[model samples]
Target chain A: MVTLGHFLLFSGLLMAVGLYGVLTRRNLIAVLMSVEILLNAAALAFASAAAFREPHLFAGQIFALFIIVVAAAELSIGFAILLNVYRTHGAVTDDAISEMRG
Target chain B: MSLTAFYALAAFTLVFAVFAVTTANMVRAAFSLAITFFLIAGLYLLLGSPALAAIQFMVNASAIPIMTLFIIMMTRSRSSGAPRTWQIAAGLLAAAAALVFFKGAVGHHDGQINPVSPELLGSNLLQAALLPFEVASVLLLLAMVGAIALARRRSG
Candidate 1:
């Protein structure tokens, strides 16, 4: 039988991969994709914990739904920012946008 | 039988997630991300939360990947170069750090698994999480307006 440990380990490794992507990818869009992975990892953790531990309560599922909505809003804004970045900077790499770096 | 399916789904999720991160082609990475989402939705179904699985499929698998692809097309940001040595080292360090942090944070679990129904989830949302639910809708509206404003062409 699948246990909570299995889910936790899965999410933990997934989160690690996302962290690796965010740290290494110079492309701004790639970084945003990594952020999405991280968000999904969080959702999985929440859902699994709710499913295994307190299955009667819908709290975990509700929270995961909220997470999905928030992720959508975030992606929309992120894509908008990507468009603006490409327009102004002429490139979408993180190194290309250093106007705010002091 | 179910255990085997769970393991298979878990492996698929991890592999695609790695591909999503490491692939050089941005479009390929986005597609890999979609596959990862789909596999995670399968895991959610296995966990007995079909509502969450459906939401995951609809948003992460469909909407998000399409939006990412559109942005990729608009920006034309293609990086076909391999990662530099320093970047590879940094990625490894970050992954190691994340693993260590997770190992330290999440301890043993002793809770029972009780599958919840969609009806209970709906009532809970309306009664208990009412404010947050309304707030989320308002947030989505604001996000839509903000995206339009941001992506609008300047007529100078």
Candidate 2:
């Protein structure tokens, strides 16, 4: 039986993995991917909680769906910003684009 | 807490979500994210929120991730070698947010306990308290518009 503890453990571990990716990855897209993972972990935890509790309060699931949609929207902006950074500099690395810092 | 199908599905959901979030390959992340979304829907089903589950499957798993993959494919081959200190700083900021929010999240349930109702999700958006869902849709639309606008070529 996967108790709530198990779910919490799994979610926590996944979140930590995501944290690693977010911290170390230098690629903007890769960083965004890590964020997505983190968000997914939160969603899973919320839905699981809904299942375990009164089985009546569905705000958790609704909130999760809301989160997913927001994540999608957030990603589009991130990708576009990455594209903008690339068009001007011809490189997406943060180090090379430092000339505009004056 | 036995190893029931619910547990199995939840485990799968989390695994795919990790795969999605941590994988360096963009296309693969998109694929795993789709699975993660579906698994979340499955969780909703087990919790008697069938309507929300179906929406998760359709909107999140099917629609959004596919769109992300399309964007990735379209943007592939672009030179994105890596980022520098400023970029690193941005990532650190996100990490900070994660750390700040995660610790006390366990006890921060802030909403009224609305009884789980499949019909609540099934009914027309205009009728129910669909404010959150509607706002989410609007946010996605805004993102789409903003991204397209940002990608527009700046006239010299």
Candidate 3:
């Protein structure tokens, strides 16, 4: 029997993996990929909750949908900015764009 | 049936995700990410949300990874360097904390899985979520314009 707890556990595991990537990865694009994983983990949790426990069946699904929309928008903006960063800095690593440091 | 599928899919999802995060080659990582999202869409199917699964497959599994690959190619970021020892330690700590934080949500709930149809989802989107839906469209437009403006070559 696949229970809500099982889904939750899976989501948690994904969250852990994504968090590790975000915290460790040096490439800016790699970091963005990690953030995508993190967002997916959250969407999974919301979707499972919608499937299992939401008072309104579609509520969690709606939330997940919105999450996807937001993630897409965020990615477009982030990648655009990353492109500009690469143009100015000639590299895309975290260490490459440290002009703000005192 | 689905339980076994879930286990298998979840394992593959994690494996691909780990590969995506840890691989040195950017193109390989993007492909791995695509596979991971595709498996995740399968998980959504198991959760009885085919509509969600379709959307996930289209947007996350397809578009996002393609965009990632485009950026990787455009920027010429072929391979990223390995994480430093201190960074790895910090990542482990953060991962542990996330695991602990989500542990509280692992309670028993004997809820039945109701398959959500696209019609129902559409109605819900049009009825209750109308405002947010409209807002989301506007947000998408804004993002498109913003991205073009940001990424376009400008005259000096």
The best candidate in terms of DockQ = 3
Question: Which parts of model 1 are misplaced by more than 4 Å?
Answer: A100-102, B104-112
| DockQ per model, Cα | 0.67, 0.35, 0.78
lDDT of 3: 0.93
> Relative to the true structure, how large is the alpha-carbon lDDT of every model?
0.87, 0.66, 0.93
For model 3, how does the per-residue alpha-carbon lDDT over A1-102 read when each residue is reduced to its tens digit? 788888888999999999999988999999999999999999999999888875484999999999999999999999999999999999999899888999
RMSD of each: 1.8, 5.1, 1.1
- Write model 3 residue lDDT over B1-156, tens digit each, in one string: 878998999999999999999999989999999999999999999989899999999999999999999999999999998999999999999999999988877775645787788899989899999999999999999999999999998889
- Evaluating just chain A, the predictions reach TM-scores of 0.94, 0.89, 0.95
Q: How big is the positional error of residue B18 in model 2, measured in Å on the Cα after superposition? A: 4.3
Best by TM-score: 3
Query: Model 1: per-residue lDDT, tens digit, A1-102?
Result: 677777888889999999988888888899899999999999998888888875554778888898899999998999999899899898888778898898
The window of 10 residues in a row where model 1 chain B has the poorest summed lDDT is B104-113
Name the better of 2 and 3 by DockQ. Answer: 3
Residue B128 deviation, candidate 1, in Å? 0.9
Residue pairs clashing in model 3 are: none
What is candidate 2's lDDT per residue for A7-99, written digit by digit as tens? Answer: 555566557657756776655666676777777677767765665665443556666767777777887898888788767666554464688
* Predicted candidate 2 versus true structure: per-residue lDDT over B1-156, tens digit per residue: 335865688678767765665455667777887887777677666555677677778877788777676656655632234435764566566656665655554453433223356666445334544786677778878998999999888998
